[model samples]
Target chain A: MRKLREMLDKADINQFRFWTQIFFFALFIYGGWWALNWSERLPVFACAFVQDRCGSCYLLGLQHQMTAPVSRMFSLAGLGILTGFLTFLIWFVLLNKAWCGYACPLGTLQDWITKIRSGIGVRRSQYSETGFKRLKRIKYALLILLILIPLAIGNTIFGSGLSHEFEIPFCMICPGRTVLPIFNADFSQLMIDFSTSTKMILTALGMAVTGGFFVGAFVKKRFFCLFCPMSALQYLLSRLSVLRLVKDGGKCTRCNNCVQVCDVGIRQIAENMEKGDILQDDCMLCLKCVAACPENDCLQLKFLNIPVFRSTDTGFFCRMEKKERGI
Target chain B: MASEEQSRMAQSIRMHLAMETEDVLGRISMDEAPQAMGYFYRKLRQFFQQPEGLGHFDKPGIGTFCAQVPLELIEAAGARPVRLCMAAGIWDQAGGELLPAKSCSVVKAMAGMAASQLFFSGVCAVVAPTTCDGKKKCADLIETMGIAVHRLEMPPSKLSRAARNYWRESVETFMAQLQGWTKQKITRKSLHTAIHRRLMATEQFRRLCRLQTKGVLRAVDYFLVTQTGFFDDVEAWTLALSDLCAELEARVAEGRGIEKQNRPRMLLTGSPVLFPNIKVPLWIEQAGGPIVTDELCSATDMFHDAPAYDETCLHDMVSALCDRYLSPCVCACLSPNPDRIRKMISLCRQARVDGVVYQTFSGCLSYAMERNAVAKALADEKLPLLYIETDAGFEDQGQLSTRIDAFIESVQAKRRNF
Candidate 1:
């Protein structure tokens, strides 16, 4: 068992992450052909827009459930929302933010775009510290709008009610709805809806976001993840999750190696010395920090507080040596 | 290549260095000392007595004055890195003639060596990190002696984002300069291999440190083992350290380690204590206080941290190297550096140290200014600290020894009362 753990700790994490991402991407994008269904409350971005998707993202179901009349929001109708959330939490706690790192189809697509950018010798862009701080708040703001906009559609707010087109306000602008279905030869969502000005504006906004997603992801890694409301919601309950990223402050040298390689550019993982649980709001639990840390046991990927993959000098050197040998 | 006058001066300095080296070696050689220690002793003797035989002469040597200059880049550029910080009083006097009366002894010695044409004999260029005022001036002094000097500007504070970016750019610029000098592009494969080589040495160094903390290795022996890396080949030094660690492990298993159980264990910090000038450490050991660990750049801090790049790409690797060299450095030269106190407290706890012996040279303004802050922090942790201010000369040896002995006595008495 110890030997197995040593092997895992020194394993090629990039290769492991790549294969795991491919498996989940295939399962979510084409699993319906095999009659596989993992419930509509799945935590990751297995888009509902994909006609043959095995599971749908929880955000869509959440917006729909929250659209019930405000008068019956706390009644028996509300119990359905409660049950859906409970199921979503159960699935979320199993892997935590790894849903974004390894399972999310949208995230996988961004990673592929980034790979292409690097393959062509184009330099990737990164946010400055001030820019990162300011942009990180967008996700929380979107989370608020996603929740309140749906509720406002069901009830009066400021002496007015929103149209049904704004019922799933976030999903209306989310690039996933416009991009994911293309894998299934479904590009009908690409056109603007002219039934009403509200529908036309929302659908046009979605198309523009899809175009931005391609160009943005090509230049920056995990661009859409910066404003992902689902990530904000997961962070609110991140403490209840079983998987964690832990840091031993005394062992950390604040080398910023983790910061340089982070997909979401979470600087707290390297700079925060007072915090042991280093899972920041933007952390995708990608375990790249754990692999980059040179100090022994400085950063760890823990399942229920038991280290599954730890950073060690031997492990760090072995990985680099393998890279040098092109193995 | 040496003139008659320069050769005579080199002969005189070599004689004094050899005597000082033999004196320390004689004191460190004990029956309980590990057989692997002989390798380090021979390496040190060669460094002082036979400078030309230190090897690596096939490649152009790059002289570095501080640890901030990444050695991996130098090696990757197909050049050898020779750390030029000296602690001998002979070189200090020789260099004192050119500098002010109250200059840092380490830099003075380096300038003296450069003046004599003894140290920078075959070095093609020098990479000098402006860590302190003394080093910056020393770079200028070395440049005047006709050796090319590449000055690496260090940021005053590493806490700000601007500083971090500036440091990254500075390191990248230094990489370009080195490549230009060596006429060899630092390819990703070469840099990766260089980083791996250093990591291998770091593994062995950490093992040696663990043994030192366990009281299996003497303080002087540990210092010698690390100081040898300044002139020795990285691979050779790592192999010798590994052999020493294996022997120390066996001795620990046999319960044949240093028997200083009753003495107070000490953690040495502050300015670096190099070879032939390790008076404070020698005094601490002779006074029955064993130095379990140290936080000196000349020793533990030199190889303690290794770069950990997440990707194999050149850009990420260079950025990682910059972070590794800058962020973790607890040198007093960097301002608002609370990391030094935290590191000291942590090292104290890990080594089970009863007191800290902070040594700063008389002219080392940076370290001397940090003495009060370090003292207050250690006192808050209820750990006794003894701060010593002296130069490279032996005029104050008796006074320094008395103070070390008294501090150890007080620590032992405190333990007894508890």
Candidate 2:
């Protein structure tokens, strides 16, 4: 049975994995949308849902920036937390962020935007292609924070005072509040609970992020990653993940071919240290490097040091390795 | 039809008279036009009159390579590298200062540096690769003896093996002379160490890249790290970098890499930016995006170092360095077949840049040619782009400011859907 499973996996590998990842992710999203009860739909506007909103509100409160509306929102945030926790539990245990690979709504949204953006002006290999594939970790970190911070806050027993609620950590700049269409509604309705002082604080945080992003135009690449606490949080979580792209040192040429394509910022050394594996914490794992890699086996994500896919789904990607051995 | 014809004829006559006036203008002032080389000739004459003045030219440095490498040879032969960059910085220095607005800023700042005594103190030899007229004119201002001047005669074409060989020989001979003059032994170990140091430093550069992985890196930071190649002493840089690497690695290991997440995600593009305009790069990072990969003079994806295969069988690393065909300063610019834009496009595409800000320097005819080529190339790739021309100065804020704003807008627009 094991041999049969391995053999079935062996044929047209990358294509199969790529397709399977897409199929699974699509199914996951379709299922989520189907499950989102009707009354909950538009209420999620300007926010991810009650679960995410409640989490952010409390996190804001912990930061001493929360308003009554924001505080009240947290009373209902159990939903985002529950869904997020359940999804994460499945992701960490069953597939190691296969949620990112096959199911994340935010990740899916980013993919659509990326496609449109690339179609308009971005391309796979038009110019300055370094670290192109690595750009995904920006969101991955955000996702991790969306889960961990709220849980950490909910469990804290620091009693009563405003300082006690400081346990909610992701409040001020949580991207989930800003990125989802649900949040767009929340922002539009000004549903935020606030006194003038608290409102000012929320406004300051909001303006700082919005204004900063606009200014970051000529300023830098992935500027949000610089300040994204979620990115910070995920950077910790990804290290222990099961799946990763690994480099077989013997098959490597140190040509920087992989660095040429990583966008998420995986340093060539970090990738190389992992033996050129792309655990790709910084990466969305969109699989761009797996395509751009010139030498076969020079790049691949592994689970406990085993090749999962090598460029193009052909069962025979070890061509570079074979060629090197001919001598 | 007849009236239009007359009008055209009249316009031609006015143009002819204007030409005469320009000729008379040459006769009138010191910064006049030369009749033969036309305006360039007059600028040349005036430029030479104030040879060591600001904006005149850059002089020789401690070392030499290729055609420019000869100045070092001449200096090492006991003639001081009393090239323009030297005297221009003296208290008495005053190469006819070029206008601030019209000139290239790189040309201006470098000239300004030389004129300020910050550049050419105690330098005694000079070599120059006559790759550009700006450099040639800069050399013309120096009051150095012809014997002291060493001009590297790089075959304008880069591909021919003979030209490469000529460059190699010129460098070797210049190096030998430099050794003779400096009285410092040119040991193989030092050169090897330099190469190895650079290799290691280049490897350590992985930190800036890694930091950006999770979000701590901004686009501006990307630009700074990518261009670390232009700094002095690769060995010292590597040593210093070790500290930075450890700090950043610890952060990443602890999963505390990026400080925040509100910054923009951007792709770096443009012509090979020469120097860190300091403010521009820092501002870019401050403004919220940092650089990632670039197609600058030093940050070539072709960046690599192959160890001498037969280590036991001693090898001359300097010879190896020469063979890189394009060293930091001498590459595409000095090549008989200079095709920097082609290489630039290839690199940008490989890097998956979201946009390109092509900075064209004033008076770089070669770059002018590249402008259209790169635009067309990017257009085909469907990559959004912005082009800015700077004379390499902080003073030209009007043009730079406008271009920068527009560039930021374009990037923001792309980011809006986010």
Candidate 3:
């Protein structure tokens, strides 16, 4: 057991996280697509088994399909949607928003871009606190539009013929819908849809969002993850996650190690003195803060109150040794 | 005669001769040292002269510099605590190779001693505090020599409760590491015993400082008694100091003091003046002014406060140790170090000194930067203050003597005006 621990200590966890991101990115976008008949039942999200769909956006599409021929009235899902929400909830709680840190292909690609920029000796851009606060509000607005636009189309509140353009509204502009399908050798998304001027404009907007955010991700760490609507949805279920990052504020030296290492630039991890449940909304649960903290038991990765890898003075120095080696 | 027995006897005799030569050389080099220091040298010589095979009582020793290290914790872990200080000599060449030219001589001398295995021989570990940049890098340099250095880090500022808890945990972690190294358990009972032992020594030191201020004790005796405690056993040193304090009390009642000619009393503050590195104190005494009290880490500042003991709890005692030691330290490591100036003023008021000598080592920036604040505080009290920056070597003696003599004259003139 001790030798196993020594081996694990030698293994670079951040690099391990990088490979995990690649595996999930492959599995979600391209895994078993050729052989499987699991399309209609599969829930839609950027990370779900099906491509070109999102769970929330799919809920909107299902809402549209179910209510299109009836009177103008909003309708909710039956048993299948309930089961899909449960499945998504299970995956969401298992890693929490580690989906953002270690699984999101977009976030992973952004990190890769950051690495490339760092390789070319370019410094990162940091947003001021107020500016970052303003940026944070964008994702919630996107999340609200993702819900409201589909509801408007299902009820014909925005009028009947607008369904072609307004159904799956965020997916029309989502970079993931355009960018992720290419890994499966799908390039049909890149072409602008010419069905209507509105469809052309939505496809054009998708292309623009993809191009802008990819460049933004290259220059800033986790740039697109900051404004991801999916991340905003995941945070609503964050409190139920059993896999948690805990902080012993009494032991924390306010060293700013956690903040310095956080991909999302979380200040609460360092500045918080209150003891219970510091799993803040912006936390990716990357546990980079755990790796960086020098104090013993100061920051911890706990799964249902059992420690997996907690912070240690030796582990901190070991991570530093690995960082130096990487440099 | 048995041939193997005869050869073994011959080897033992040769080893003894080498030990004797080292002692003689150390004494001859420090032959110009004060009588009290020579007395301490002889006691240390006797203590270090024990043969091997002494059993668990002679556990592996851990050497450290700053008084912030809780020696009792080291004791509870079953390791002997040895205080590492700047040894007297011009042995700078080896340390000069390792340390930057701008580094303080005390750290340089420490590097020299560790490099040669001179004063630092037979030590299992060294605990060095990051009190200054020079000291921090000195710890690193010593670690390069394969000496295990446990760097006891303190917060840059001690104003917050978080900083206090951080320091307390750091001390606890250090104690745990020591326990692992020594294969001993640091029980609550043992920690209490250790705290009790140190409190006794602290009481004796307090009395010693009190006597020195009252002009009942000589300045050389004050420096010697406290400095020698760095090497002496805590119990024996306390008893020795208690006895001396009693003798001095009798002498004071009889109106007997070493000074036939009245010297101006000055409070010594700033960089530590270890034995053999006693040029500053030696100069002050020789120039018709005696240091009545000191704010140095090695002197009265270390003993100013005893740890607040809670007999039933180990964590409380550890917190008390952190509070007592880290709180009063005037080291520049703590920013906006107003506590230091406050401590100096309070000690000066009690000691009733005519002037304050704010001493700084050449590379010790923390104490060096405090010159303005110390000067301002002393000026407000209308007390004369002299700033002296020197190194470990004797090359600065002539210049230092001239400044001390002038400061003494000015302080005397100020007294005459009064």
Candidate 4:
């Protein structure tokens, strides 16, 4: 450990290094994206016989299973299920937001491009914490609605309840695939083949979802965070995340120094405070606060007691270091 | 017999004028120059002899400031601070004199004084914040002729840290500019002394506000307290204050303080309520209501209740003053934060008000902006809220009557619940 510390004493990591790590993380993400690409990727539980699709499979990137490209290569349906659960565990436990932070192909590409094309001044919506936070819940709610009540009109005289089927929402909505198509696959045919009823549903869903994103991006940049219920899901489960933002408030000067580097605009510590070396929601657990913190060793990315990153979380490491010494 | 009658009337007039002149002379400090003294004497004589209704100070929404401005701040600044109050005995004289019956009675009374040329013109300046949409416009209308109407933009933000900074800055700006305008380096010693001296005026004002002895404040005597508008002498406005306070104190001591009327306690807000307005007060009284005090910024008696601090303590003084009578709800142009509404309603509760009549104006940004929060607050309190929308000139009373009747009924129902 001493040797590791001595080795990196002179190192000054910069944005380029962070960008380099993001590139590797994307390749790593391909492992899970590959599994969902398979056809006959039958869900394991009673859900398969009872319902056609599962939320986890949709999460695993199973847009369509029958014509899935990876299915032609791999025969076993269980392998796809196995691969997805493994990926969820890896991402959920080890690097909760690693997919969003470093590995998400779309996110990485966006970051790289954004770095190069930097003239887009922050939109007014990004600055209004109260306004933007209030609006972000709509997206996560849509995700839950899209998955949980898929194709079901809730119980009534004309009852059509939640459909347990793959939502055509992604095909109808995600412009990201067009910009950077995954697997070099064309989704246009899949989009056109959906029945008229499905098309209307898709179109309505598309208008709501797209309008929300565009409006969020333009009006209050990242308005999605305020209403996106999935972020809340991620936030609730973020306690299990290895990477977390830790604040050494004793060292904090109340100068509001770390707020600018944060993509999400949480100004005060209480609103932005997290337990470990990485922030919870809106953090992407990217160690932005660590980099932005002016106070020495005020923020850190720690693995157990080890300082994986030279962050503000290190003082607590040293404090623990002293307690162990006392023992 | 005609000669005898004329002679007797002349004697009575002479005696009244003499008593009024003595009252004025006694109140003036010896430090005042002969001209200022003479001005005081003339003002007293004219007011007593003619007693033209002091309606300018009695405008709708004006009662809020009239109740707050410490008479000492006015007098020491060499200004006469009036109560701008109403529901006094002079309503018959001042009411409907200039303002139409449909107009806000408080506004009508003020218009009466303006039409009668009683008070608003003979003043150095008027001081109050933009307490409400109606009052702000009225004060602006009265701001010409170097009248220097100072409108403090009372803080409108939440009561958090960010809001506090904004309010402090506003307070600094208002007090500093006012210091420059008043031509008196209003020091801590001066302001503090003025606050201490204002205990006398407060005591006096409390006397008239008492529901005893005179049944209610005679509109004529209410006119005197509201004359904090006429001059800028903090120390000298106590002549009438002394007389009124003495009479009320004596009455109270003699067990004369009894409930002559069982009018409902109402929190009058929105317009600059002037005294002697027959419409608003009369309507309130008809509806079994009597306005105790109100939440107005200009010409409401809030200034008197404010505690004076050391002048140098800018932020502390501002925080105190900002919270004194001007809460975030005062600046209804901004969304009245839930906390602001909660605070204002709590104040209503403290004042033991049975109902709130928030006078909103069409196209006025402040009241309209705060309308939702104020509504939500009233809903929370379960208090009946009457939102009266009026024009800048309180010109439409027929439009307000049915709504008023309904609101009064709602309050009566709530009282029954209690």
**Fnat by candidate, in order:** 0.59, 0.00, 0.00, 0.00
**DockQ score of each predicted structure, in the order shown:** 0.57, 0.01, 0.01, 0.01
Better of 2 and 4 by lDDT: 4
Off-target runs (Cα >4 Å) in candidate 4 are A1-327, B1-121, B124-184, B203-265, B276-278, B298-304, B308-331, B334-340, B347-354, B361-365, B368-372, B390-418
lDDT of 2 by residue, A42-136 (tens): 10111333332221121232222121233444677645544544443334443443444343443444444444443454332221223444444
**Clash total of candidate 3:** 2
Question: Looking at candidate 1, what is the lDDT of residue B78?
Answer: 87
lDDT of 1 by residue, B286-387 (tens): 787889988898987788887775446788778878888998888889987888887888788878999999999889999999989989989898999999
Q: Give the alpha carbon lDDT tens digit for every residue of A22-125 in model 3.
A: 77666556655544333332222443313532222233344344434334332353555556567667767778777777766667677778778766756666
Give the DockQ-based CAPRI class for model 3: incorrect
Model 4 has a DockQ score of 0.01
lDDT of 4: 0.45
> TM-score of candidate 1's chain B against its reference?
0.96
TM-score, second chain, candidate 2:
0.65
Error of 1 at A110 (Å): 2.4
Candidate 4 residue-wise lDDT at A260: 39
In the range B302-357, model 2's lDDT, one tens digit per residue, is 23322221111112234434434322232335543324444444445444455666
TM-scores for every predicted model: 0.93, 0.42, 0.52, 0.37
- Reference contacts reproduced by model 4: 0.00
Off by over 4 Å in 3: A1-327, B1-41, B44-57, B258-262
